[model samples]
Target: MASKQDTAAQGTPVSGGTASQHTTPPKPSADAEDAAKDKKPGTVSIDQDVEDKDHQLPPHPEPLPPQHPSFIHCMPPKNPAITKNKHSVFLAGSIEMGNAVQWQPHMVKRLHHLPITVCNPRRGHWNTSIIPAKDDMDFKTQVEWELKALDDVTVVCFFFDHNTRSPVTMLELGLLAEKHKVVVCCDKRFWKSGNIHIVCGKYGIPYCETFEGLVGLIMKELKKNDLDVDENGKLLSEPSSAD
Candidate 1:
């Protein structure tokens, strides 16, 4: 029987401290269920306590490519006789001497696409007669025409065959060696191979064994000069390199 004033003076457990102090709310019913689920086998979340791995992943690599092929003939352009600003090349080689076939036509066919005027003597007028007669008009005309070409041309190509005695070809070489640019290709079996090689050596001209070699040298020279001549001596729309 404490007096009201005395009771007020003494501090009482304002709330039910002793009973509730150590007590937690009965975990919400679902909380036990959640814990039970977590304890259940294989209950992992993709986004659990695991770390974000995008930044830790090793980088992905790139991929690769393929391969290609090669060439046979240094082929010329499809069309050659089409331009005005073209160079000139004279085919000064064996006619009826060694191979029995004239190479001028073949040379023209190969080089026709180039910006060049090919002066082929084989195309010039001639007869069944072996030698040109000093008095024959057609022979004289042919001779004069060829001689004039030598004077006017930019390059002279000398090809010697082994079968025939091409004395005139030799003379043409000597005459034009100093005056014009000359490319000499002499067959080893030519009667005057030694003499011709000596002359080419003296003049510092390109001397080759095969006709194909001669063409290669000419193309090289053209490339060096940066002339319109293509890699194969054709005037191509898109200048390409030899393969």
Candidate 2:
């Protein structure tokens, strides 16, 4: 049998009784205890679940895919599909053929995260020779599609480009002003800025001078009506009792 001094030197607990006797494990060192306490809170270890009961922390949510807004344009002779969305925006702005800036693409990019449909009037292939006559089937179809989309959408965003006259845009604004579903962005450089300003003021319509400001106003309107969505395309707020 080994001497008690030999057993102690080998770091084994010594027992005077039979070998069947059990020995208690040694306590952890002070340094080890302090190190454990110093560990960052909420740091999940391999042995611990992400949602540890002792920590009372929720599991980290997985990242959601990017959300893109649906777009509808006047062409291919289709009905206003924008009505399929919970909310829609009619891009009633300056599209003076080859003259006005292509602002629709920029607007669409900015509103990509929202769960709303964007109805664009600019045709993909416009025939300049097509006469705007009542008998012209193509012209009639385009006008009818725009009219229906304007009526079906929740908001009408009107942008008066400084480069073009935008007579049609002005007319559309007048038609929707009384309905109180229009927002205007009139560039100060626009020839008819004064008239647009006066009309917007008269109807108490929200109007802005910059493109960014226009987007902000539209977001505000959507949030006010609970029609806006989160980054994951989920509705930001629950529908009101009236809705």
Candidate 3:
């Protein structure tokens, strides 16, 4: 048997010899030592493998939102009236067949709801006399009144029923359209197929068969204008791309 000191010396592994190889823990460098000394005692030191694994994960990006279209705001609280450049509608029809009694008042009411001034010279029976008289003075007077009504309106809403409309109403329409008012010719006649309807169609004027329908059509056109008038009754006209 070898002596105790000789056995111990022989058991130690040399550079060229193989024994039970034990790896020594890596020593801290001068900078690492300084960093370790400055750090808190329980601070975790991440290995290169751990750092690389953390960086390897794909980044989660923030989600994006979808896009949408804009809409017009509805009528405002105590909505202002339309501008002076707005087209006023003239209710033209007959006194009989209860056209004035039933429709004119309702039409006028609707106009009040809008930013428009409705002019109906034939609000009573007196104005209807012009339809039959055909007298030069009477016709001239009617013409002047009709023209005066059209002076401020950018458009005309003419209401004529087969039972009520006469030659005078026709003449009134001609003057309004000639003055370039956007003519809205409506007929609530129970029996329509007449010369008046043909004339309205030829002139390219829009007409509705019922009062409610007519109101809807007129409102649609007014919305296109998007105009606003001042509180002092000063009218401001906005440019409209739609006719």
Candidate 4:
């Protein structure tokens, strides 16, 4: 009984008024979409099935966790004549390089000539995820070595890279700032450098901007300790004319 004009008026799609044409629902935000797409733990996720094209197996070896390592315990073998001389120059700084560690070798390369040994924390076993109850040898070794290295070092150098969040390094600096011969090199762009600089000034802990400058300060410390560093940065039994 309805007229063509009536039917046309009722069925014709208007600007956001008629339901004749298919109207797509509003899309969700990225976060909402991700939440919906993610398979929460303990939930039945259709995507988890191996037959599902979306399901992918993890790598053969799971990645390791963050490590707070110690190197003082690991000493390389040397000839008896080498004279395993003075204690270590504890390298305390950022070691988190994701899958690999940095900072230690670079510092060692620079300070290798110094009479003191390098007490590097990164040189030891570095699996931090391992529980102590089942396997505590690594934990015990690092803790003991660090305690010894902390006390025995003639000088401690704290190097802060702007990219690293070094909470432990800060603690080490605070502990040794007034108690020991310590030097700090904090990049100006680092979030905590201002606080460190102020602390260094307040406590009279020598501070510098560059790693090379830290080396210069280390040279000065070596001089005070009756040792000398060469122009090429090799530790010398006595002063050289190059100085």
Return the top candidate by lDDT: 2
The per-prediction tally of clashing pairs is 3, 0, 1, 4
> Candidate 2 clashing pairs?
none
- Worst 10 contiguous positions by lDDT, candidate 4: 1-10
Model 2 poorest ten-residue lDDT run? 2-11
Tens digits of per-residue lDDT for model 3, 13-86: 11211112222222322333444455454343320111111111111111211111111111111121223324
lDDT (10s digit) by residue, model 1, range 112-215: 44544566664322234535678877567667777876675556777665565778899899887665367766756678888887777676776765555555
The better candidate by lDDT, 1 or 2, is 2
Encode model 4's per-residue lDDT on 5-114: one tens digit a residue: 11111111112111122211123323223434653444332111122121111111112222212212222111111124443476677644221223444455445444
By the TM-score metric, which is better: model 3 or model 4?
4
**Candidate 4 CA-lDDT value:** 0.49
Shift of residue 52 alpha carbon in model 2, Å: 55
Off by over 4 Å in 1: 1-85, 97-99, 129-131, 223-226, 230-243
Per-model lDDT:
0.48, 0.57, 0.39, 0.49
- TM of each candidate vs. truth: 0.57, 0.65, 0.46, 0.58
lDDT for model 1:
0.48
RMSD of 1: 44.1
Q: Report residue 79 deviation for candidate 3 (angstroms).
A: 26
Encode model 2's per-residue lDDT on 1-108: one tens digit a residue.
111211111111122221222222123223223434644544322111121112111111234234443433322245666645666788888876634555564465
TM-score of 1: 0.57
- Residue pairs with colliding backbones in model 4 are 70-121, 71-120, 71-121, 113-235
